[model samples]
Target: MSRLAIAAAAGLAALALGTAGASAQTVVSKIKDRGYVVCSGSQGVPGLSRPDEQGVWRGFDTDICRAFAVAILGDREKIRFVPLNAAQRLPAVQTGEIDFLSRTSTITYSRDTAVRFVAITLYDNDGLLVRKASNITDKKQLDGLTVCLQGGGSLTEKAVLETEEEFGIEMKKVYFDATIQARDAYFAGRCDSYVTDGTAAAGQRATVAKNPAEHDIIVIGKGTEPNGVAIAYGDDQLFNVVRWTFNALLWAESKGITQANIDEKLASGDAEISRVLGQEAGFGKAIGLDDKWAYNVIKQVGNYAEIWDRNLGANSPLKVPRGMNALYRDGGVNFPFPWD
Candidate 1:
């Protein structure tokens, strides 16, 4: 063929490839077609995503996935949890193996640039779990110690490195593919310290430690990381569904709406509550969901506070305080957008 004809043929092939790629990127449509949203969770993080004795996944992170299912499929139970570790979480979402990642991963600059993080579901800081016999009261004490952490360059590793640099100290790092592996190695004395999110450290100690009282979870740094669900880049519709589902949880908490009170709140005279509960017409249609989307989430999954209290709060084994995860009304950072 002539050079000009060859160039034209290459352009047509490029157009076809672009069209095929775009068609393959359908996140929400695929979930709708499959009738369930597949969410990525940790292999096991007790208060975050571990299965109970009944083999049922239960945790704050688990509820986040359930909330997504309720928002999209109008049924909280319409979800399948794919167990992943820090190393496997992002790729699972990127490759469309999971709808969104909620395995206690945090938002970093690189991740934010590569994918879309919908909302900050939990506000946490890097923490270290050390044997109580060590009597290490401060995070800096962990400096120069070998630490066990999830490998494949997880944010926990990044946090540890950053903390070491900021404190003018050094640490020996041991890597594992999964959180369970890291915790096992820590318990087995592979490392002097185990580093991860504050709540996760607590959960690990609570669930996996031979004696929970034998270890202490300590904050290692000044900065708090906002953990959120991440999706493939540039799909605004699916992103909105995930983002607003989180907001709905926060908003419900702000309004004192709970699984028990959602029905009563639907009849509330407050205009904002009414609009968010789907008594007003624009919410569901605007988000490409049914009018009862938020209602279903609240009814089936409960609000953010309920999920927290149920999984990580005083009622749960973790017994973690709300801290920064609380709604703004309660002086926490979780302030959702106004529903107008």
Candidate 2:
């Protein structure tokens, strides 16, 4: 062949290879190549995502990570939890250091556009936690009181400033690195109040102190905030996997489904149950996952209510009552998207 003809042939071969590569490449493809999904969790937040003495990870955030793992890898243990600090969480997801982040991250406009949050696994609101002895029942009572907060973050700092301005409350902001330290400072009388998410306040109160109830921690005011998991932007397939996994959890809970009842439901041959478990027609194919992806999540990680009650229930240290987090059927805001 002539030199020009040879060059043209090579270009055609390269074009074919590029097309084939593009066709094969997908979020699930890359995730499988890595062997395990990289999940970002907190460095140490007791009931959210913290390591136990035996190095086993548990809590609501950990469960969220496990749910994603089961959805993709068909095993809850097929994830490596990357414990991240508050500042490192968003950066880690943005840089692709982790496949998904379950680190009690709030879904803010900036983060959604920048880092891309999937479905909100947990919905949370900001509230103040004040020591009962301070005689603070409401925001007005916080006037002239020193409130300890996790400093340097634009979100928390702005919330504190807004609280001060809106409520006409004078608050001295004492910065701390972690909630544990802040809670200690508040208990030790270094600060009169601790301002954080209501869920976090409950967790801190439960984990620290000899008897959590002995020190009356009051939730002063609630703010409108949506907290959830975050993943990288532009990967629609991965986003669908994450979003559907969360919805599956809520859907299962709404339908009175549990790990124990899952097998029974599958065997019962109910059309809705069959569709969810992927025993009939599978919905996972639409999301680029195995037919039983949702089944794996429910079987391994349980549902939304199960996760919440396990971590923040009365028996758990946090003892957080399911207020706004209750299912929509129970008159709360938690409504699962339709599976069909």
Query: lDDT tens string, model 2, 1-340?
Result: 9999999999999998975575366556787877788888786777888888999898888898899888888988888888887778888888889988888788887778889887776666665666666775677777788888787573656667777787887788899887557767877879887777767767877886566765555444435667787888767678788888898999999888898889987888678888878876556777768889888888888888889888887658787788778887797789888865
Compared with the true structure, what per-residue lDDT tens digits does model 1 show for residues 1-340?
Answer: 9999999999999998985676455677688899998988788888998788998888998999998898888887788989886667777878889888887878989888777788888999888888999888766777778898877777677788888878788889888877678888999998998988899888888888989999988777668888988998878778889888898888888888999988787786888787778877766976678888998899998888889988898888888998887776777877988665
- Candidate 1, after superposition: displacement of residue 255 in Å? 0.8
For candidate 1, the clash count comes to: 0
**Candidate with the greatest lDDT versus the true structure:** 1
Residue 82, candidate 1: Cα error in Å is 1.2
TM-score of 2: 0.88
Residue 93 in model 1: lDDT? 75
